[model samples]
Target: MSDRQRSDTVHYDGPAGGWGSLRGITRIFGKEWNSPAVLETLARQNKPGGFMCTSCAWTKPANHNPLEFCENGAKATLWELTTRRCTPEFFGKHTVTEMLDWTDYDLEQQGRLTHPLRYDHATDRYVPCSWDEAFAAIGRELKALHPDEAVFYSSGRASLETAYLYALFARLYGTNNLPDSSNMCHETTSVALKKVIGAPVGTCVFDDFSHCDAIFFFGQNTGSNSPRFLHPLQEAVKRGCKIVTFNPVREKGLIAMVNPQSPTEMLTGQETQISCAYLQVKPGGDIAALMGLCKHVLEKDDEAKLEDRSVLDRTFIAEHTTGFAAFEQKVRDTSWDEIEQNSGLTRRALKDAGQVYVEAERTIGIYGMGLTQQVHGFENVAMFVNLLLMKGNIGREGTGISPVRGHSNVQGQRTVGIAEKPELVPLDKLAQMYGFEPPRNKGLNTVDACEGILAGKVKAFIGLGGNFVRAIPEKEAMEEAWRRMRLTVQIATKLNRSHLINGEVAYLLPCLGRSEEDLQASGPQTVTMEDSLSCVHGSIGKRSPASEHLLSELAIVAGMAKATLPPNPNVTWDEWVGDYGKVRDRIEETYPDQFAQFNERMFTPGGFYRGNSARDRVWKTESGKAEFTAPKHLSATGFADAPGRYRLITLRSNDQFNTTVYGYSDRLRGIEGTRNVLLINPDEIKRMGLESGQMVGLETDAEDGRTRRIYGLAVTPFDLPDGAVAGYYPELNVLVPLSHHDVQSKTPASKAVPVRILV
Candidate 1:
């Protein structure tokens, strides 16, 4: 190898074997499971047997074998079920000021919080408070603020029961400030799908993988982000299905995958080839590529006299869809030059991809953050749906649009009514079911909530589960907003930067994690989760609580609600808090057809699959059909269009999930021990007159003159596309301006940032 190669390469010195290998051996010998607590939780995940997987929103069969967990899943599990503890005594020794100096990993590594802590600004320390005191203080602060002056935030990890009750409490209190993790992740998908197909969820299920003849994956890294998907990707390939990948970076999962479960492949070091074709598009070029594909499909179908072919579902389109002619004309009018320039791909490549879809009997398009974190994210998703509609892919066995959701129960939370604005049916039903007038006003979303806090319009912030302050873009602004709040309540399992932000009366209330048992008045309680595939499953905790005082999220939310809400004769909050089954009963009452047998279905393996419009080729659009939405214009922003600037894409390492770091180890990329580095193309490094391992600064092009910079970042050149660079998220989140967000989804365009590399 050349000296340049040696300098650019990352070295791993932690332990032999990649994260997967170490985890496997550890699971056998009981080496602390060597996985995240979330992974361990997933191992026990089933319809009613164990806790819900606190990782991704993807669902699986409840009858899967014992070792169904993936590497990152294990990391999530271990991180949650660690032996470390942050007790009241521990807090007494270290003030909030002192803890603020600690890194994010160090704060969380201190382990599960054993008690509720209130930040005492006078002493600059977080002191332990009894549950009664914590609830009372929260109630006092919340009740004092106008309903619209408070924001209720929910993380995807929150269960259906807690989310339902949270929505109830927020409405009863007359506030719609329901900012959640969903607003930050897949809101674009929701907006786009709803506009085009009248549904926000994916149309396909996990079983669809078996029936798919071809899978077109765009802007998603299945191996690292959604590890559970690797099995399906491998299976589809083995079944002779064509897998086409479109991404800026070539992910290992998209190339060749080695199933840890397969004996032959594991022993021989052989890997399964996943993608038949790989298209490397520029960041934020998804819409252009998709349009190009649509154009190809239209042209090919017309020439072959297949315009009204069986694959097109002409009947469904004529009966249910609107805006077809206009959209088709728009597609026809689009110039190939414009497509190539905007998508950064030649027409031949676009035609090749479209041909794969045209010839296939069933095709599935799976996308992730890559498509949703762009300026026109919602439009990109709409284009995907439009492509599916053109081919009659929706409401089918193996063909549909599948958006890989982040966070375990995010979709589930949305299903159970964790929304800023409740739909008309659910809102009216909830009001009737609870015998109270629920607020009909739309609530604040994630971005709106942050803006509210910054403006001091929101005085209290209640987060069910998540590090809201750190996860958001413009960290400094978010933290400052959090500090200005009159009260902040975090119902969490572990310590996070959010808690350390320290509101005027901040309370970090320890909650039972997914792995911890929830023994309520009736018996052991299990929470339900709705996966990305629209499968609802039960989750019961197995391990003991980190502390006896640690309450389940449902109980905490109930307690706070009881203390804050006005007296009501309609529903019994205490009864539901005492037993989670009652919460399910209420859920069934609110959404009768959806959760009719909520409790009984828990016993059924894999629970039940929710209603899917795609399976029946039923487009739920306003016209009762899937509509093709054409791009109004073609424009490319971000670093891709910024001449002499590198488009910096923020990614999560294999060892990390979201903002939680599990040690700086990226096995596939050979990165270890640190996240403060940049992955650049080697040729770009030479052209820039820079050497490997040399620290550099990344400056964003902004009019405000506020430069976002990171120091000591080693430039590790790799196989990145020209003028493109990659780095870990959250660490690089600061580089993403709050204004640089998808206009429709309000999701920060973290995947595409314009930055200039400087020595």
Candidate 2:
């Protein structure tokens, strides 16, 4: 049978309260108590002096109960603590070709790697290699290449210390090719926030959700993407806060949620309403919807401001902002007809949303990749900033902009200077602190790195935790480039797609997972991580190492540094590797303000938080105050001349997390045993004369005449708006060309692609 037929062998979508819910309940209870892995993982969750949850970026209260983990968090924990092991003997029996043929789920589920393995081209198999030999080979190859030819990639799962050290090593080696996971997801948010607010971080904290009178949620699926966010949403609803959601699909959690935390609600099976108003906006139409709301508010402010203090903060705007007059003029000049046609929303609906914001005393706006992964993503965010500034919602108790970052430490990695284009001031500071002139040349981001590889300008690649190939867009081009590199080094816990696509010399170096203890020469060492909320905390693993031969990410970096960099009299790379405290000392010396008390703070339960823009209201703009930005006339995703094509938005299943597939089922979406289904509106399917559950092919409508297609997909009728559809990511990333990326951020517009469906 074909893969699609095998996937469809099982299908069941009964009521969630029956055996389905019982299975889920059994999985949760059984995994926690009966399974040894679950018990060990639960011990780490929210424990005092332990690491922050590595699953999601949500931050909890400083002193929460010991079991403050979410459902996905439990999944991640169990996955890490699995008993299966992929040892060198296992690799000895399987060839790279054979391994590549296996599905991603099977490849990862084979288990954690036990030792470093080097791929042999002659045998087409990977063989075990000692740490010393692997380091020497990598160093030799890297030293042979010019600094510009080497690329370093970091994942969001990497600890702050590992990322900082990796940056230092890359700079020391004289290269800035640091393409990271951020480049693929939220690079647009960072780029836009910096231009408008002078800071790339969000301006809201967990506490801000409690105080907000209303929140405008755009393109964010809180239930699956960040389940921990549901608790706060529940609390906000209890406090009578209005939630307005705008998305292509109606997410279940956004409309009504059964709070598992509430004993009364849980026992009675009661559900609480979440979104006061849910608008089904077309895919890639976020800019138009947002602009329409801004226009509505500006046009009616004169009459509406009579009773609503939230309509406009005249005092704050006059003192702390500029460019409002220009922004207001642009909103006034914008026509409602254009907004309605582009946003696919009626003028009345837009006005109703505007009125909510106008009446609420305090309001916050939260967005996700749906808004960020677009050609005009940067401008889309700037438009939101304009709206917030117009209403003076920023730097207040209950109002601000919150960009829901995906990775656990994505924000933190950027915080400690992990940028391809490091500012001159930070470079100068590092030079002064480390006694060496830092490289001033700009570095390569994800897109730039891929270009370099394809052009043969990049020779070496180093990945610090992540499946680089699958995580990036333009998979075919990226895979081809990976094969052309002189050397590829992966510091990961398990085998991934990146490991299969090798270069002349490729090494898969197994490392300690987040749940495993890290022992250096000095003894057990602990690392620190920063959550989305800007809170820094210590993470010390209690579980034994997955393999005795596996090394910590820090050690691997140090080993590579020893082999690659020339003897530097100022920096003691050996000493830092010997004792993790020495690394902390270096961090303190480098970024004293951020890493002060790095050694002593770990002992404190729940490590200290860093400085945040929301707490102090310190606008770091050129004018020393927040500024209103004018909206540029641009569509969210640029339209192609696809006469009969619809824009398709790609998302993740509830069982998947950034290329790591836990299972093939998406329980909440009623999908079972398959990830190859296309979600379409019933009207659109009927218009096209396509039946639900029929196999269909999707082709991209690109100007280059490139035929990007995914065939044999079952169509599931959903409540999607016309001209919009949904599919899984990475699978659909093939349709998104590398050239079709956000202009300012270079982030692939994966969430917005024009395609034609055929049965």
Candidate 3:
């Protein structure tokens, strides 16, 4: 390893979530974030049988404490429940053109949207409009267009109830162009897992963390992204589990973590070691790393067999899985030189990591966007699952495949029917339940949606709750395409770049947030969300609403449906909106098997787990057994290729969640005050003849005849493999082309881009 590269005391040296995290928390909820009501509001957050955290969709531990929310979760709650306001007066003071100049953090800091707004061409500002008037106008535009011309985008933060209604409305209005945040982040995980495990979600739940003897974290950072995961990691370390981590960047969370929730540890200033072994694989080399482990395991199994001993679970393999012979042969056939160079790890290191896996009886493989945003994202996940299946490590206590979802309820949105591919959702059942034949055509994911918009094929776009333009790749193209739409509607709690980058006619409708109470015609209401582990529970907001004019996401969807649809008797949007329980009832009717006793389960403790047949070793696949799939390649790109170009992987800073920027300082990697810098290995910087703090231009290496570049980015020498670089996303979003994505899932390959540095 290279000597320690310092950024002049910028890097945080303390364990994650110590006094530093407490100070960070105080900074946010106190004067810095300026959300005084957060602590009182957070008192109800993640409490037993209370509302869930508005942040990442990590599954909560059973018997959660009164203050179970993490520091980031507190920031999210403050962001939602802040006393700040963005009313008509705020808009009157600033033009849409002016607001476009503000940073994402500044724009959101302007605070919660308080009233409905419509784009005014005459004044170049958003003028206040009545909710009914805006809804009717949007309905008129949507009704006039062909259903195929309308694109409905969903966000992960939207509750399952709201998402279900949005899908219903889109189908009733006649379209399946249901693109969403999931399409951008975890579509690869969903696609690959479904093909191999019969279920598209994680097989293991929160309980696995307590029992697993070995856990492999491939490209996931538990500290900044999923902070709640630190508790389990700390526990696993205490129990002496082998936590092997494979990531391109050395995330602080993966190295060490101090659980802020632990009073004893906090008082003593002690920290727990997270990873027993950290393998710094190159960008997009996750498949190579997994396959290397597979190769070592196969060799060990072969040796054990010759000695009349057994290392592989031969009985579990023969009884529950198929295609092992082919999987094993492929691993053996792959050259070690190719694996070593691609993975940026030695054969001995991989063998040592595999030894830990072989020694542990119960192992869990977990991954995040680091693997999923690559060109081989789907295959990347499949490779990990393939390794776990070799030992029959799934379908038992403490062992299975888990995709650490980037957003809360991203998986649930799919479970409750926010899918681009129509087959994932029950089209026949939706039609039967709603008295309308749902659109059978496969819809657009994020990439396809952008293409459609650019081509002028999509006339209208309705986003349930997301900054689609900012979260997706190809920012310049997306911004231009966003302006091409005839009509645009954003259901949001606050303003984002998307609200300004609008169509001919754009409307921003304010809605009740997760931390606020929602009162409807029936009375107080509760919305449900499904966590990453597939536990469905209710989230009821009891805090005061941000604005009196604010409506629930359910009401807004229902109002839009009422305005657009032609009085359908079978499904009454207005009636359902009056009482959220009706929506749950409808959900139960449509998905009887999955949502069995839906309303009843909401009151049950810890909600209810939507059981995965794959976890029970019951393969719902056509073969009636778990099937192994060989990856298309061991690595997305090869070494000794693309000379003078660095493999760039865009990632989020510790200061942000998805596209929401909480602050400019990223304490995780020691990035402070700006999101404009790029972290490159010192070797690359030296080779390029660039100074450590030199400003450089980045141009994408693409097959297409177009130049995409983000210039004037400050480069900092950091801890990463040679010929690799890391930069915050949405800034380098232009470097990722619209066409560059996973073929099967159409997810943008934001994490893997080949770019050359310019001084």
Candidate 4:
């Protein structure tokens, strides 16, 4: 690497979105688009009668805006619409072994895949093959394996239509091993919220921000993961909504932000102060922090009762909840010392935050992977629910739990039946509709599927979308075991590392991106996606596809199903492929309550919301009331005993989305030309006798009888709390043991991997 391109920090002290954001947008747009025609397509993003933004799951406004996309959203759009193509010739020139040494950014930069390619063992290269031939080979292998031995994985990028068909195809094949992107991220939210609030999805909509008195953010980075969310935060701040943030690092976006779309602010360089209070909590300390807050609320209620005043919503508690006594007792039994030690926050700080919660008439609690990707992630989510239940924050217009989901349709994928847990979906209804007995046995999640592969139990792997191998934990182990599978199929838009990590009979099926037009035999087809807010909307592409050979995700899945299964009278794969409305009609038949008038609602302006019952105080649980659960431990991560070890948080860069690295630099953090550097507290660096920019190594403290380490890492000084170090994800996923995950959710504890630095 050149000296100019070497890993180093360039200090940035400005707000997140402003002139800096404009420059980044221009750079990416110029590099990706060759003509101004692409702007028309870009303008339609997240707007009425257009495509959904393929970046984050942030919702679109009820009213229309000219340019609705943010910086990272534009990057994702342009990245998909790039003119560059990875053709058959390109694959012929490079063998899989040679490309293994390339960086992830370089691999994707090679551009979109244009043709169906199959791995040839003799040549050790991917050779172009006809779609029909590829599907036949996949069917043969899938037919050879036991139903439980095949893992059908889906990425979050797929539309609800595609996800529905994918799920149906898998179940018809006699298995329910439908692990998806949610398993690695927000599965904890779904599992915990369902057990407590009797609903798995967030209850807030865009309008909720306008009505909210305050918004409490826990471990969610609005700037990097979901930049478009800053607009609502900006508007909420302007309207006097108190925005309080609790995170390990003081992220720039949550502190203050300047809306780039506002002309007056953009020209005058005016910035809006976002957070009224910013609390720098320790990594994996959210559970303790929440407990402290609940304890403070209880104490405040006690004092209020003496004066005939009430801080707690006693009426709501009596009418709408259960287990309050048990939850309150658990909080009372906890001591301040334990809270402070585990949370790494003073009692006063927790009390102050609790006071804010106590005073606000309507408040929303928002969190991200930081809270969900922990060892006790279920407890972290449940504690947040308990805090909200104390104040009756749920089942209201502007007050609820909002787990800010990553990926555009991760929640939608789950809603459409892409789940490993059999009970989560309507198996009986599916069986009745499809004329086949659906699998009732529990299926394998992401971690379990990978374990199955390692144990030589799983024989085939198929992904509808996403770079599965690169995005999951225990990647190195998975890559080695992946080769042992009899079949592996990836339905993707671009070439990724997962394509190179091929099995013996692997096929890469190129599919249409969200922005590309899907011209079916019936006509131009519009697919639908459910946003983070549970609002279902239609996405119709205007731009032509990247290549003629590429097929729609719907077509690819339908073709695979047709080729794999015998001619069943119940399934009309050809008809569904010809007209997407047939697929929607079937979805409505399968999930009538959620998808009633699915086709008619597709035309509604800004789409429609699948109502959350918890918002209406309607509990779907067995007890017929919202319940609060107590945690046995205060710390979210089970690493309190491992003193002196740094809790490593695997985060995303501003220039990236999920696991896709767009560039070498993280402009938000002022880091240039590298993703391999570590961000640690300056005090922690000094205490360990390590200087800034020193090369070091990190080894896992998991002690799982296996060696997991990464070397040649540069240490950079950051302003995070002590005992917490941050690094880019996937790079550090190696140090996180596969078994180190929440037992309830099975989400890999990527946020709290206990590691020791080596000099």
Candidate 5:
């Protein structure tokens, strides 16, 4: 049956967490892993001595409760600890062509991959292959092409040791095409922050959550993305902290939440209200909304000056910041009519929200992909820094910017040198340590890599983890282009669509998951990961490997490096694989400033903080001061509105993490059974003369002349803005044009696509 036939929707007015979350956790555990290993896994999650939670990058608190895992964290743990396995026998029964017809959820539910397999073009199937044979074949394929022709991709799931080795391997091979998960999610934050605050990562650590008196959330849904963060929000609320949110949809997490760990709250069905003010701004309207807040604050600062009261931190501005005059002029020049029209918020509402910022002595600004995945994503983030700068809400305790990272170690991967730009990494240090001059030319990013593949410029692809073909925009085009590549290798724990889309020479290398023990020749090895807050902690797998044939990611990467390169006397790939500590030591030599005493500090009780210079009022910018950016216009997205077009925002359901679909339910949004649905505002539905459950189709208003469309989707009314619509990602990724992205960062504008409904 088709997805539309089985799909249905319901009205869910209940709070985000309560019994609903408990039931979801119970269902996943019973479905995937009903063994005592689940409990053991939960106990180890987010602990310094245990495995980092693979669900999200939210950090663990220093003083934590015994049961620190959230409902989604439990689900992610169970998912990795499933009993089911995808063996060679399973692959023999189904050909690659046949599996292409399966759903993403069905493909993943087949469980963890247990053996290495090589694709056979004649049989159109994957067959069992020895490690030596696969390695030799991949080496042959890679050696046939220039180093520049190969694109090395790493997922956010990879540990620091694995990622460090992966980056070194690529640089040794004389190429810098290292595109990763951040390319699509938070590259805008990295690019924008590097120019504004001279740091590419968030300034707030987990401890900052407790000392802040107020927080402003922009385009962030803490419940669905990082459920573990709700605990801090719950405590902050109890302490009477003011939380304000500006998003297109009134996210359930921002509205109210019930802590599943609390017996009194869970048993009594009590919920804590999360946000004091939730402003439902229009889709892609975050820039205008942020500007409106800044305008109100600027005007308030003027009034405060008259009364001899301190509103703006004029002292901090004069001593540590630059371009304030131009930034202030831009804010004052922006009329309220433009701000209200673009932001879909009233002057009164924005002023009230600004008043909260004005009153709070210390405040934290938090955001997610909603603000970073737009046409003006870079400007959107820079504007937020501007707002915080005006109030001097940075470089001090309890005051900074927090970007909620989606992947567990995406930030870590970037820190360890998974970047396309050569200037981002320390090439001189790498050359001195590795005895090789690294390539200096800028390499292909995610979008650039896709374009290169389609143009026959990039011939080989190696993925450390993740479903690249499925996660990126222009899915169909990427799939077709991927097939033409000379070689493709995926090092993963589970099966996904990217594996089925085989190239001329494809190898599926099964690797141990983070929760599985990596017993190397030396002994049981431990890998470390950096969380969203920049804490680098150790992760020791608690469970045994799913199969004896499975290898650690470090081993696989080292094997490829050994086979691909003709004996390099300078690098010892085998030694690093035998004991991961050797890898950490080399990492220390390369980045002594940050990774000093790397092995010793990584396993510390709460892990060591990778200090942020911005937090200490030290600016690394060229001007030696924090820079303020003023955009040329107030539009968040450059797209002009049309009669039948609506701003489309793609999001994730609670059941999915990134492109990995776990089930067919979005419990928080009241969607179940299928993902083939579109959420529209009730007013928009009425104005369009459409019914609530009307089956409809959508076509992109991209004007690219490529007919991007989806069919047989049910239109469900939701509490979204009138001119906006929302749908699940990956499925809706087709509507996202390849060329539509943030011009500065080159990150895809997944959150903002313009489409028209066809009844």
Candidate 6:
């Protein structure tokens, strides 16, 4: 039996990130971090010479506390810098067949990969292979096929340097089949914001939190996902700023926050309340809730006119916006009954929430995956922008859209260069600079890549970083397609489940972690990363390599470029590999307007913000002015109201970050020892004659007429909306069909999956 089996249940009645966090950190990284070398590297984290924490993308403050790290940051850092080694000897001892039995957490915890590895069919194991041989083999396969047959995938953890090189390599090789992690998380934010505001990124910075009048958190749990982000919220509360939240569950983080770093608070077991008002809406109802607020605002504005009061920002709308009349008309025309039914909130409750908004001069709207992982993801984002436009909440301090991203540098990857579509910028400019005609054809995204692989249209898939297989939905379908690929390559640091689920030919190219030194011909180099607020800064690793065999992500990209395009003297792949400054120089040369003083400015403390024109009130769209959209997304709450049906909201636990499970328990939600449990409404459980902790199975209510079932899941009755049940993901990913996605942004509709539970 395993530790998970021994610990069937646990009760947690504690605040978020206090003593519980200290216990978690000590439990995970206490032993190995006592050493001198590891301690030195830990000291360098989030300081002047240190790299950014590999956890969340919450921007580092200009003047941060000496202990400037969170519990999850420590977990991520120590997990990467662990002394345990997964070498050829370890591979010889444990075959690929044996690895399939290990849990996802246990698989990654086995240790770091030390060298390049290739799967051997006869031995049923991965055998050590030389880097040269591995690169040569991949190059041969890539060169053998049409460029469209290859898919170059990326993860958010990759730095700007590696991402740029990967994009250049793919375009030179003649394909834009570059699917990245952004497609799954914040793509809708980008798409919707671009259509309305001419920039996909946010308009606010860290300082905005301090100056904002009121802050609204929609479908986001900040305390658990990004604990450090709570600092601003706590401070905002202290200064009398109202903080409001909307979500399906009453998340512990939003309810209260306790910083583990504070000794007095930790000793006294006290926590600070974060959200002044929390509205618990049903799953997939963000748009309806937003619309309800909008409807109330319009009604108040109409009444304000009769009372000779200023409710709307008439000057800003007249000068800076278009389509507001139509947008206002649509909101006014929407029925209160439909809004109430879809939002799971009374009209009175919505009016109360809208009163807070009406009273504030400036408000900031913040959201997470809960808003973007639905069928109306783009519409959800658009509605928030619409709400802001009505109040003139953007292009000013303490007011704008803030989508809290997951990875440390997810925003940077796209800003530098990583996308399936190649026409985001000028192709002629890129061709003139790089001396290559970039592919104008559209290529595979995350979903399309899986489809291409299933149909045997994709011959090779190379991941720069990330557990591509586990992060995506449609687990069974992806597993089959993943195995059918002629060649699959992963450039990663730790051993993920994606490595175990092998292709016909698979290779694991172990790379250095964020804290490890990257030495090239130009001496040690520092990689840059962009945070959620668009601040680009240098990340210089302060630790030695875990294994001497490790290669940097920059080196890996350069090696691939050299292998695929030989006799290409002008590209300078060999020279650039030795000194990464050359790569930055080229990046500056390519995107001169945005990154003019790239190398010089990054060395400065705290770096600089990559300025967004939208922040300066310059709209770069066709209209040359900010536009308001009447989005097509309405309430999806009716889909789950049918008999014997529930809407499954796929989420991550407090102990987990994305697909990387730190532990089997969620301390915030009172879960322990296993991921195979569901949180349902207690009232519904009684009505259905079902007892808590009983076994149940779920089948997706998909439109394709195919039943997708996941069985033997343990159920836990709790306080949830009537038709909603919550479950942790990658474990329950089978219920989310690949085809079920947002029509506008193509993001997976993980939060809107209508499922039937078998009692």
> Model 1 has how many clashing residue pairs?
21
Instruction: List the candidate numbers ranked by lDDT, top first.
Output: 5, 4, 3, 6, 1, 2
TM-score of each: 0.94, 0.94, 0.97, 0.98, 0.98, 0.96
Please give the CA lDDT of all the candidate structures. Answer: 0.79, 0.79, 0.84, 0.87, 0.88, 0.82
| Tens-digit per-residue lDDT, 591-687, candidate 2 | 7887788888754554467766534667777777777776575368877435578888998876777888777767767677888888887777788
Off by over 4 Å in 4: 1-11
Q: Flag the better candidate by TM-score, 2 or 6.
A: 6
Given candidate 1, what's the lDDT at residue 225?
79
User: Which residue pairs does candidate 6 place in steric collision?
Assistant: 521-578
User: In order, what is each prediction's RMSD in angstroms?
Assistant: 3.4, 4.2, 1.8, 3.3, 3.3, 3.7
Candidate 1 deviant stretches above 4 angstroms: 1-43, 46-48, 306-316, 635-640
Judged by TM-score relative to the true structure, which candidate is superior, 4 or 6? 4
Candidate 2: which stretches are off by over 4 Å?
A: 1-37, 304-310, 603-607
Q: What is the lDDT of residue 67 in candidate 1?
A: 70
Deviating ranges (above 4 Å) for candidate 3: 1-10, 32-37, 637-640
Q: Write the per-residue lDDT of candidate 5 for residues 19-73, one digit (tens) a residue.
A: 8888888889888865687788898788868888888998876677788787788
